[model samples]
Target: MKLKCLVIDDDPMICDLVKHFCSKLEEIEYCLSANTGNDGLQVLSQQKFDVLLLDYHLPDMTGQSILEIRSQNIPVIMITSEKDFAALAFDYDEIVDFLVKPLHFDRFKKAINRVHHGDSNSKSILQDDNDICYIKDGNKYVKVNYNDIHFLRSEENYVAFVLHDKTILSLIPLKNVEALLPSHFKRVHRSFIVNLNKVEKTTLEEITIGSRQIPISQKYKKEFFEILNNKLL
Candidate 1:
């Protein structure tokens, strides 16, 4: 399968070079390029990608910040000139490899190979089937089907995925999980992520999911209502 990839860098030349190199590889395909982290997030929000080539420094946000926000199974290769951040990058389980700037084509190819070969130490929580998510709870990874999920409630450090039968709490933040869920899941409030498929009804003030009623954020009310209306239509 051709790996769909995104290259995010402030340097135009580096982006072009990476794009060119990826074009030569039969197994890799360049999906898009972004000059800033914010723009990169916009692309990620709209499309699914297999790999990401991220620069450490960007005008709006650092690559690390973006990774923190959206932690999916997709491998993220850090492309930067800075050598000091290698250790820090390794700390992030999502970062597959670190590639220093003025990158050698051989090394770049090898990094892609690592992702293609599934050599990353961190096992992705995302599975091939869209209907289920495997979340780490204590010493075990619990599989929760998407249909079972009613809504996700975020605590300070952790989020609670409230299912129809029970709730599964994980150490990972809610925003990261939110990015991986399909469009059916919506952020009704800053603290709540609701499954549109499981939604029973919605009033002007609250959304009913199964037996639970979750409030909608005032700031997101208009957009939230629009999505709900569109879904029903």
Candidate 2:
């Protein structure tokens, strides 16, 4: 399948060069460019793209900051002049490859190949080939092990990932977050998704995880109980 792409870079020339490189390949359907992070995000929110070519430093924010709020589904190839940012960039799960500045068509082709093949040059520190995630906590991304997550709660437009010590709130719909989660996480109610491994007590009405009592709605009660019954000793 031909991939649609977006190049988000501060340098206009870099963007043009990438667009040119993309035109040379039949694998790339079309490539669009945005000069800053905000413009890129605005475009992303309006349209769906198969891959993102993100620059490390934009005038509005660092590329890492953008990764915090963006959709998890898009594969990203990080572009930067700084080799030092590679380690930091690879910490995000979306990143497929790290490209140094002054791009070459051959190197760019390799990055595109990785995206097509569903491969990354490095494993994400956030996921680390396991059930781990980095949740946005203020200005930083805090590492949270999946087992530590008692449950996820929906609050308005945000979803709160509740761990034992604290809760991290992200500006994403609960359903969108739900798709990225592992199978053990069950949607018990419209507002809640509880980790079965962390569940301490379960009743026909609610599930207890630590001090939190999550309601079980009629729509989900049967399947939730069925899973619990299968595990009962």
Per-candidate clash tally: 0, 0
Q: Write the residue-wise lDDT of candidate 1 on 1-233 in tens digits.
A: 78999999999899999988898888886657999988888888888999999999999888888988864557888887865455456556677776777877866776787688774322323332446555656555576678778889998767888987788777766776676677788898989998888878888889987678899989879988898778769
Across residues 92-120, which tens digit of lDDT does each residue of candidate 2 receive? 66776767887888768867876776643
What TM-score does candidate 2 reach? 0.54
lDDT of 2 at 205: 90
Q: Over 4 Å off in model 1, which ranges?
A: 121-233
Can you give the lDDT of residue 222 in candidate 2? 91
Cα lDDT for residue 185, model 2? Answer: 93
Leading candidate by lDDT: 2
